[model samples]
Target: MTNIPEGKQMEAAIQNSFNEAKKLYEKHGIDVDDVLEQLSRIKISLHCWQGDDVRGFLNKGRELGGGIAVTGSYPGRASTPEQLRDDIDKAFELIPGRHKVNLHAIYADTDERVDLDELAPKHFENWVKWAKQKGYGLDFNPTCFSHEKASDGFTLSHPDAEVRQFWIDHCKASRKIGEYFGRELGQPCVTNIWIPDGYKDAPIDRLSPRVRLMEALDEIFSDPIDEAFNIDAVESKLFGIGSESYVVGSHEFYMGYALSRRKTVCFDSGHFHPTETISNKLSSWLLFGERLLLHVSRPVRWDSDHVVTMDDELLDIARELVRGKLLEKTHIGLDFFDGSINHVAAWVIGTRNTLKALLRAMLEPVDRLKEIELQGDYTSRLALVEEFKSYPFGAIWDYYCRNAGTPVREEWLAEVKRHEREVLCKRSQGEGSVV
Candidate 1:
């Protein structure tokens, strides 16, 4: 057998690499320890939909309408709130640093049968209690899709006054829930609204639906909740399955609305055209807006919602946030569901990659690069940027994971497999079903 270093030996090896990497970074005028501390403070909101594949507790057995779909019949899918929370706990254990959890109106944990419009803060009381116990902040979203009222692919912009009012009421109620969470948790809860109101084919009267949406949004925001507790946001999409031809909430539409109404505009990574990247939009949006909400996701082709990887765009996004000093004004949340693999593993992989990207970005000598560019040394700027790419970023990242008391390198994967065998596999076998 090959002689393999274990336990203390492996730890010593990691420490040696980290020490050498720290020196290299120090030479660049970068404080590796300070960078790690800054990285620890940045929390990404973990979306709860990934655990249950977007199948919320309310309206069980209901098909996922509103242009949403979760591929793969991945085994060990959480069927109940308890299971979902447990799975999320496992993911949190593996991911370094503390984070928040984002919840939808449909994820209300209660036995009382309540429709969307009937939802209240009481329904989410259990969630708040659990979040408090786990020291997690909570974020909320109005569930405007996958409901009977939205069956015709129209929600807040529906022509029928009753139909539109129903969604409006639901959104208003969602705001209350968000406010409650923030009040109890001592952090502002971002309640984002995204509706699937559009036509499958091009319609001549595109203006009417958008006009109705604007009016409804005005009504929803009419009764202002305390901003200290609840911060509202509007998300726009390029296109979805049902709204392929025309999506009411386009980028320009929400950008205009958000600016005019002084609301946060959410930029979902997978919500734009394949060629368009959200990283480029960060600086412009920050210049005009007070705050931003980001839904970081990976799109393979067209808003496919793949698990995020440490790709070029992801690195650029992280770099932009660090360079522009936008982290303080931004709320980072994940938005993707991949049922093909273990849900906990999906969360771990996506979240870890996101943190890794941020760590690499923070390790860069941003001030030096800016100084070089200001000096008109374009050649040196490009050279330094490319050279930093080959630096021992991995060593620093491994050190971060180790210091956080989380897994270093690929050590977390074995834990995921062990959890799958011990906890996840039992769910499928006991229920005799796979999600």
Candidate 2:
């Protein structure tokens, strides 16, 4: 059983730690309470694919295509929407912040197999209702892969006009659904477009596919949707499983397109070369892009989509966002799926690590460092950085978790394991559920 502290004792301990940390931060001209409040308000959009391992309801548990793969045979995968939501809610209870949900078009709840071109917002009515009931925000994505039309490793940029048009219509429909979510939830929905349109081997006429993609995107965004209700975005990938040689929507392509079109640019952390880091690009993109959609993930040698951890790279990302004050200009979201362990545990761990990274960044003495830098005291700045590493940030974090009513530290794992025993194990028998 988890050693979660009792009600009154937990509250008192948290308060005592918070009080000491508050004084410590004030000595460095930082406001701990204000930082905590801001952190509480930041919503990390949780990816829906994590719960189900990217296997959507369409085609009845078919494998994922589109340069995506979820390896491992983790028990108790969510086969239905109800099960997915239950698992997601259970994970949220262990996380210490209010967050949003990011959904792909394939996750639409419907009785019939809705074709790509014919999909409508009504299909996701259940999602909107559930999100509203939970007081959560929603984001959307256009599913351009894992279908018959995209079997050739192409969708929006397919050579055949008919196939390309089908994907375009799907994207247009996605934007309309996103608008519906925004209007109903009273928050703008970010509808992102990412297609696995590339060639495995070397191909001639790469420019042609990109041109077709540009035209198709123009058609998808031709209709004006109010920005208040919905914002459109396009994503780019470096390369993937079958698309090793080239990806039509490369970073340069999307960056130029987003700049010219005044659209949000999605900077996926795992979508770049292994040596590259998206954190360094934050300040630069904020100068031109209206908004940035960040897909926070840990890439192991490639876009393997490992669960995020509080590593140096992740810490750098949080620090960049905090130092640049780009939180309001950025839409933070998770974009990884690890099926090697408990799916619920994966979600909780990734989300909590992200929150913890952000807290660490927020607790930094940014102003003092800046003042030292401006005074040309580089020596002091470097020394102060090393010194601040020993601050009582962990105590503050525990307090924050306590106030959020989540299990502090390792205590959350016990709850997840209990859930696995009582809930997940039962689904393994007498059903066509676990894949």
In order, the Cα lDDT scores of the candidates are 0.93, 0.90
- The 10-residue segment of model 2 with minimum total lDDT is 426-435
- The number of clashing residue pairs in model 2 is 0
Q: Which predicted model would earn the best TM-score?
A: 1
**Candidate 1 ranges with C-alpha deviation above 4 Å:** 1-5, 430-435
lDDT tens readout by residue for model 1, 1-435? 766668777788889999999999999899998999899998999999999899999878889999999998778889999999999999999999999999999998889988999999999888988999999999999999998899999999999999999999999999999999999999999999999889899989989999999999999999879999999999999999989999999999999999999999999999999999999999999999999999999999979999999999999999999999999999999999998888999999999999999998998999999999999999999999999999999999888888889999899989989888888888888544432
As for candidate 1, its clashing pairs are none
Task: In model 2, state the lDDT of residue 188.
Answer: 88
Query: lDDT of candidate 2?
Result: 0.90
What's the lDDT for residue 381 in model 1? 100
- Candidate 2's displacement at residue 59, Å, is 2.2
